[model samples]
Target: MGRKKTLTCRRWDCEEAPFLGGLCEAHHEEDRLKQLARRAAIDALSTSCIAGKLPEKPGLKDELLRVIRWWDKACLAVNAGRQDNVLLDETQYAPEWCIAFADAIIQEEMNFRQGLDDDATVAFLKKDTWTRFEHLEAGFMSNGVKRPGC
Candidate 1:
């Protein structure tokens, strides 16, 4: 009897040999490309949200920058992968995943603003931005003021 081969990539209908990361070369490349696509999507979404150009809404560049900073801070928690940081599972929340989550939040916020009055929109944006930053800060600091092992 011949030795059975290991499972290949998780991608649909792929048959190539699994490479270093449990993915075949072709599938790996495809995955990489998909990740890049997600990033581009997020970038476009962020830009549109910042510029308020997607739905003919006015942009809030300053608020967008604040949101970006908050996103960056959240990302930093997972920046080191499993090497030193244990707060995040690198595999669970990679850069693409994080950006996608943020993108979704921004999209939803914009969608909500469409139906709201000007004062309501301003209040919503302020509350939303502050909540996100607070959530990130709490999530990152819940264990204590000092970062784990830092």
Candidate 2:
């Protein structure tokens, strides 16, 4: 009988057995949870954009920003290691380009809430922003970031 081969995780400076995709069990689970959270955050942000209402709940915007930043860090880590598909899965849960768009919407909404005068806020509210937001939301949802209620 042949002995099974022992392989270490591909992630740099680690010596854990490869569980899946050259990552150790810990790294694999961490990456999975990060992707899941990223996808959910993208969906929630898309939902908020579509609704055109800044959620009354505190820290929603902060959470979205944090997730986006985490994504950026993950990408950087992957790039630094020159490892393909290390931090992300095969699924296109959250695209790099869309994060910028999401951030822009978040920033706009935050600015509108914090900096805009009452009249400006009223004028902005009167515009057909909802239609534009809905279009953007539809695009994101269709691209695999699942929309809420669907």
Candidate 3:
């Protein structure tokens, strides 16, 4: 067997340490506790915001699923080093930013639909939620808007 290398925790300060990827057992336990606490808080907020009843808004649900799928694929690529960088160059960043903005708008529409009792507004909100992604995708720099070598 190869010899083991000694290491310190990556967390700043204090001598209690473990190999490479940081954290002694105690610190690792602490980190897990903190992470769970934060996640619980976020879950509480989401439940409260949705009135403890998350409805099946088809359009918003579909978009959320789509975004989740994209994120999963991106994460896989990142882990495999296929997507090595977050390109924040204007051409790449701008369209992505616009897409995020549009997604927020759709989320607002979904929230409004859930909160309000207006039937007319609900249909319009649903339409807006469905169409926003297309509008955002269109904003992406095709051959025309893209800067060279990007």
How well is each residue in 18-116 modelled by candidate 3, as lDDT tens digits? 843478777788888766645533432333222244435545444444544434444455555563132212223333332343334344545667685
Task: Score residue 84 of candidate 2 by CA lDDT.
Answer: 26
Against the true structure, what is each candidate's TM-score?
A: 0.33, 0.35, 0.33
lDDT of each: 0.51, 0.50, 0.45
- Which regions of candidate 3 are displaced past 4 Å? 1-55, 84-114, 117-144
**What clash count goes with each model?**
0, 0, 0
Q: Model 1 misses residue 75 by how many Å?
A: 8.4
Q: Flag clash pairs in model 3.
A: none
Best candidate, lDDT: 1
**Higher-ranked by lDDT: 1 or 2:** 1
Ranking by TM-score: 2, 1, 3
Deviating ranges (above 4 Å) for candidate 1: 1-4, 10-34, 41-63, 71-98, 105-132, 135-150
- Give the alpha carbon lDDT tens digit for every residue of 1-150 in model 1: 444466767654665778858788887888888777576546744564422344344444444555565455446655543421332422233344336544544455465567744455445645654654454355553223544575
Model 1 poorest ten-residue lDDT run? 83-92
